[model samples]
Target: MNFRIPIFSLLMIGFSQSAFAQIKEEQLILDRKREPEIKKIEKKKTSVEAEKNYPPREKKIEDSLNLRYTVTDVPAASDFKTSTIQGEDISPKFEAENLNNYFQLGMGNFGRILADGNIGTKLENEIEVGADFHVLSTSGLKKEYPWSSKQNIGNVAAYLNANGEKGKFNVIADYGLNDYNLYGIYALQPDADTDLKQRTNRFKVNGYYDFYSNEILNNVRLKTSFLGDHFNAKESQAEIRVNLSKHGVELPVGNDVVLNADLGLNLETLNTDFAILQENSSKFLNATVAPQVTFFNGDSYLMLGSDFSFLNAKNSTANTDQVQENRTYWFPKAELQFAAADEFKFYAGVTGGLQLNSFANLLETNPYLLSDQQLRPTETKYKGYVGLRGDIDQQIKYDFRAGFGKINDMVFFRANDLFDTSVSGNRAAYDYANSFSAVYDNGKVSEVKASVQYFPLANLTLDAEAQFTKYDLENYEHIYNVPLLKAGIGAKYSMLNKKLHLGANAIFSTDLTTNSFEITESGSQPNVFISTENNDDKVGGYADLNLSAEYRVHKNFSIFALGNNLLNSNYQTFKGYKVLGAQILGGVKISF
Candidate 1:
């Protein structure tokens, strides 16, 4: 069905290009009016001082003016979902489906504007609305179901920010909203069951105030903001900041030192009364107070910072159930830099936090006779990382980062322990890599390039990384190792007097980790089956290949085309999650 729609869309575009041209023209006008700041910035600046005097501002103005609209109606092929074991689940065969393979019929428009150097001057305003609708189907299912739930989701977002200088103070306010047709903090799985149908609404506001002073002994900045969302439920958070920094200051323990200090307070509340027919609704309220101090030397100097946060949470259910959870976290981050060469620089940093989550009568019995307290760990996760960076005249640059950490009271879900949660050994992950690029910036032509780095380690896991996720299910924790070496290389080149450009990228990884299941425990009843999946740290590796091209038809118009999975590779980024197979997409744009 997806493939058929794309074919139909092509025929329609050829038939009605002229009719829609006028609509595009009106949209361009509205685009400029909506983005005043963008027009101001692009008005041509003559001096560096003028640009520097411009107060710090969001980049939305610049980004909004260069918007692109895409309309594709094609059912591209999808990659098959790999099983826990390397063996294909032939009994319940899951066929490959296209990524963005479903048909799309929607209208989207975006715009932005900017302002020049001015204090107390409004900087930017932006608005955007985009939508997509598609029909997805599943042919094979392991379990019997009356029907496959329809998949439909739409999102809309807009932002506004204002900046100005009031007397000796710098002030700014920002507001925005993002609505998604999904729930939870975790990334949405394409096949995951979701009762959430409509888009979720979220609203946020942030503001900062800086009291400016040339006095070398005393300067201060104060900030406070609030964020909240209301749709299926209500969740709100607020924060405050007070900071002071001095230059060329002498302290009791040091000379020629820059001293800085900060104090903050935050409160977050989440209240939800899950509908019995839908899911369990729970309400929670949390508050915290944080304070910290940071110091940075003049240029090329050492940096140190530390802060502490305390939190309390009270949860209530529609059934008049209540629980309390408390936690305190200490976070400290530090960095150092060393010049290794006139053309090379090296820097390293380490950051992590000490966090403890405890339940004081935090759990109670539910109607299902399950102990909620057992589902959570008393001593949770405290993760950290250390990384280094090197730059060699931009032509050769690399970033290497390694992490050491785990959750003490990690949660993992199991079918057997549906109601009971067990504490798993800390699951740890460590990944480090470095990339090199052959880059050049010269008059008339310029191109930025980079190549992937190959590095490997143990004790790592891969999951949905596109967005945050949250759930009330048993904590399903697994220890997976990615000792595979991987590399990706890509570059862009411009021709036709820099009017047209082309780019391509390819990534590959070898040394596979295949899964193997074993009987961890048998059911209490004789002849009852019980088993778990084990993995082989060795097997066939996976690879991904992509290529794309762009052509500048004119100053106000351009075209782009691309193909992914050019080799039609079949693989998965993580177990159970399906990847997209070979696909192609192309579009055109017109801008003022």
Candidate 2:
């Protein structure tokens, strides 16, 4: 599950600008004339440089001591079920059972693990190596009872840095795996006979270098990365991205001052056995580039950028099934910060883009498995957005955004009725002998969001956010009228000399518009049309409540107890997805 943690700096900039606007008009005019003088005064009134640079500092070595283990049973509605079509006396049934039982073992400081501190050890020639890893797991399935599943996730990363006297360079790599297994649940079949499994892996490696050493071009940086993944198919995809960027350039470009540019090129390829089955499995290759230019004033900035992507994909799956897609995108991104007062700032930006996907990859892995399919691998889209954000005070800030977009030839999975088995002329009906289809359609989507953060005390903070999204399909066969909204609030407190930490987060989500699923025929044959008008009417949200206490017994030995899902709240963030309720576990650690 992905959680959106409201960004803090984006709000501070807006708030700082707003506060500066409160200055009197006369002061503004005089301030402009006295800008240089004010700058000189500021420089002269500064604290001692040596003292400022050598301020008090904290040591890094720490350890975790002690441990705790806690588990609980949760109650909720199940999202997955097995049913038979052909008018068989098959109906979806929900079995009541405990969902989620997991233990969290905290080693050393929770914050240290959460922050993922980089361990850099000096090697020969100013070279260094850094590594980091995090793992979290939960067991025992609850809610959508009967069909139980086990969930696990972990991330590992390592990097090597070479900082030479002339310049700096680095190479880094990361690997992540997420998997889920459902046991004793019969899917796509009748009877609790067989179980299903799903797994996904993502990995990437990147290389970067700073070309200039001691010049204005020192702000210029160039880097490239190779990213690969195997999510839908067993095959892996490899892509390369090369970027050229320059920042903090104080120069004039025509009438606009302070200009910068960022440009990048991306090349990608996919190697898989599915390509052999679909015949469309040719050496997949493509290239894309995005270039951006920005003009900045003392308090405002404007940006223009565009992305051009091209792809060459082949599917030899007879006629019509041979797939290929090429795409291009044009976008304009801009932002302007207006300081309306000395202590307040109001800022907003409008951004949108147009994209054309001439080639679409719809078939999962191998297309040859099916004898007939009718999906055109091409699409076009348009999108745009507007948002405002800023700080109300030093301790409070907020942001909101709204956007609209439309996608033409939007690919969708299409299915047919199993009984209508007239195979001729129908590619999907003849080949799969099933009633499912994936096609493209034209659709529009809109989204809105607002979030705020407030620090009530020096060591305590509160945050709340809301998001609403809507999707309108112009020509869809399987479903229609899909709209969803989400809202959430969370709080964090720092205690025990900032060593012990406690936080709680709650997220609420619901569908405003109803979606219809085609019901399957019962008994002999499966009904292809499963429709739902009122939806599941979900009303509850997931809560992430955790408390961790760490005590520094000595300079290098620290003990702590960490609790995750403290309340053991039982809820699912997505339909059919089960999350562990609560777990409390702790462990000791020795640190350098």
Candidate 3:
């Protein structure tokens, strides 16, 4: 989804596993039920529209995702999860009452190979078991880029779910592997060896149970994960969440009220062999208890809550060189919903919390990040917002929201030092300033977002969304690599009695910024600092236009094709990285 220096001395620079060792890490993936990136794929699920909307599995129904789409997301996030230009929503909710199986195989230019499928079966004791998998690999952009390398990325998982009058439970495990080159404009060496590679993988387990009989333990979620690379850099993390609620209790007030509480525990430990300066190793943990009460009369409702948490972290370069850092925090939470009209509503809320920043998580966004550079957790001091949404008759729906917040330890990235210690030293395949390192800064942010959906005709769907953010930092001229303005617009049309589907998507983001570094040594000593005025570089923004088509050959089969970067973009997603361009994939889908 993301270089090789040919001059690399493979034998002399083979990554060292002899450094201080950190244990392994595991991961857990929880998919929310949302529309797939490809809307046509949803209709392809079944000939009957009713089955298209999966029968409810959990007793609780999540809010429908059809109203509005969440646009691009913050780059500083631990999970780096945000909607892309495609605006597709993907979450694994495998507990549907009726499960169908399908298999897809595709091939395209640039050696692109895509395969995805899911299999499930009903078991005794009201239990269900299934497996889902998707994998894609592409030849590097060497055809046009001359310097890019091929990439292979994908994931697969197995799950077991059961439900009854008492409750429901599910257990899942998954693993993912990504292999790519770190060919940066600056990292390239005359003798660079593109054949040498960097590989990363993660393994995880997730378990969840919802209870109907026990009020104290109504919902429990548990997960543990491990992430590491070929060099032995690793992160181990575990999490637990529980929700308890009391409903329909008679109170002194007129309307019946519900009391609820949530408990959470998250912990992680990481070790990334060595940075340019020091070995990186650290641990982070957060425990929190939140309680709230809600009262509703008619269509109007109100709720209030408070979150209290204790945060702890231990960071250092050596086993004995660590000091445990601890702090306690309290945040306010509240929301109000009013019936502005029978079909329209107005709502507002106040929310804030601590965001865990870990290498295991950050890698999702910037896979080119160095193996080790310990970073502090980013804290959201506070954020307040309001919004209103409704429909124009039966064909159109809209949503809007705006908010302002202050952040502590806001994180951003910059190029690594091209040369070791001010212009000299052996470098890893990724260290040529082509790779990014995390930097911490504090700042205030303001943002506004809006999205709309129109179904003018039964077979035609129109969607568009946009978001803009302003960052005012205390220590940087600009927030490098994070998008300041982003937007997406798409259209999907069905013809030939719904058997033929056509779609187009246009995803855009403003130009991104990057800061370079130069080292000058005074005699034998060296110093490190950014010279923003002279080193700042701009990476041009892009309009990634894509088109897709699919034809249902029969109730159990279909054929499809996808065209990416139809504009043959030369823009870079990162400072020096170029995206694969003008490629098409054709495939067949079979259902059983």
Candidate 4:
């Protein structure tokens, strides 16, 4: 504003205005150059902070963009070769073996010799055929006794068996021959010569057939046998049976039921040529039908049945007229079983039947039986029994039973009269002092039996059994020659991987009462009365011990030795007959 605007002011003002304009222009250029760098730095800083909060977004794929894809062809399977893989050799360590035939031979004291053989073969049609033979012979102990007691027994059997899809069939034929001397008489004048040679022959044939179908009939069996002796005694028997059974009949109680039926025919005939016997020929015929039904639940079972029998018998005798008997009998049977637990069970039953006692049967039980004795059939009216049988543990099993029954015509053995004044020179009717006669009595019997088996180890077993019976005779004061108590104990042990076996057994029996006579002088006449002072009417009790050992020399061969009556106890199974003492036998067995 000075009138005189100085040259300096003008110049300063102009300089200031120009300098401001230049500064503004320079700032614009610098900002323009660094704008991209500054924006990048800010964008990075924003991205880092966004990433911390959320994941970064994926890039968008647009359809408009052009892309390329490549396809490659698969290789053909035929281009490669296949191969089979091989495995290591694996063979069985044990051999394949079978045992179907065997042979045994033995010798012992008392001049005993034994021989046995078996041979078997299988045919191409799957049928099996076999044959067996056995012989046992013993020389007499005449050095100790006055008579020779020699014996020889031989047996032969042949069998054929066939198994098919439908059933199994078997046929067997057997024959037995026995030669023995009756050496039981010792008091007949000491030098009385008697023809005591005896010979017996037995022949049998049996057939069995079973069906595997679901039909009512299942099996059929047939048996026929003939027995003859040199004493003009002959016996023959024949039997045939058919069985029908069906199972798994459902009941309303959600249980199953089973039914069984059996029909059989039996025929027997016996003829004896004893001069003094009244009856010489006896014949018997029986037809029986038995039907049974069983009902089973989870742990209990009931069995009910009945046996209907029709029996006929005819006897022809010299002293008595010919007699014929006919009878019909019905035997009812019922049994109940319940398992209290897995290892325990209780059972009870009632049973009855008619048993045929032929001369052959009587003689089989007692070979010393007198030939002229009367033979009759036995009738068991009824038998009731209760039993507890089960395993106490895995290794022990026990069974106990008690029964009572009545028997008609029960057979018993009695010693023949030793002294008969009627007969001259101590020669009685029986002629043999050690022989026995069969007697029949109607009696009631009560019996108790118990048995125990223990298998503490796989290779060791022990067993014991005891039986006691009491008889109330209807006609006799006592049951003659019937042991009141009988007991047996046995044990078997195996060692060395079953290569060695040891066995021991003991048998004991109580004393028995029998009738015996003594010779006494009465007014120069010999008198016979029952002995009372010499214990001759009583057979003393005895215990017998038997021991056996077997050692396997090879898989197919074994050696065995047996010692009988090892305790050397003087025992008599039959009165007046002493058993052998301390006898040993050794043998070898070979199997194929």
Q: Give the winner by lDDT.
A: 3
lDDT of 4 by residue, 110-201 (tens): 67776776687768555777776777676645555566567787778777766665666677788877777556653443453545666678
Please list all clashing residue pairs in model 4, or write none if there are none: none
> Candidate 4: how large is its RMSD?
40.6
- Supply every candidate's count of residue pairs whose N, Cα or C atoms clash at under 3 angstroms: 28, 63, 18, 0
Predicted structure 3, TM vs. truth: 0.80
Top model by TM-score, which number? 3
Model 2 agreement with the true structure over 1-592: per-residue lDDT tens digits: 3554444323422332343332111010000111111121122212112222221120000000001000001101111111100001101111111111111234221121221122435566656565644453444454434443544555566766555544456555766555544331212222222233444455655555544322323222222222222223334555555556565455745543665566767776654433212333333566667787766554445666766656565544433454565555454455555545423444455444332221123322212112223333333344666655555665766666677876666554333333333322332211222222445677777878776677667766667667777767766432322236666555554454654333444445453222223333454544333322333334244434433333344434444444444455544332233344444334433344
Q: Please give, for residues 177-204, the per-residue lDDT of candidate 1 as tens digits.
A: 3221212111112234423232223333
True-vs-predicted CA distance for residue 188, candidate 2, Å: 8.0
Alpha carbon deviation, residue 350, candidate 3 (Å): 1.0
Candidate 2: regions farther than 4 A off: 1-120, 142-148, 182-193, 210-232, 245-256, 270-284, 315-321, 325-329, 333-381, 408-441, 477-483, 512-570, 573-575
Greater TM-score among 2 and 4 belongs to 4
Ordering by lDDT: 3, 4, 2, 1
Q: lDDT (CA) for every model shown?
A: 0.30, 0.40, 0.60, 0.59
Ten-residue stretch with the least lDDT total in model 4: 83-92
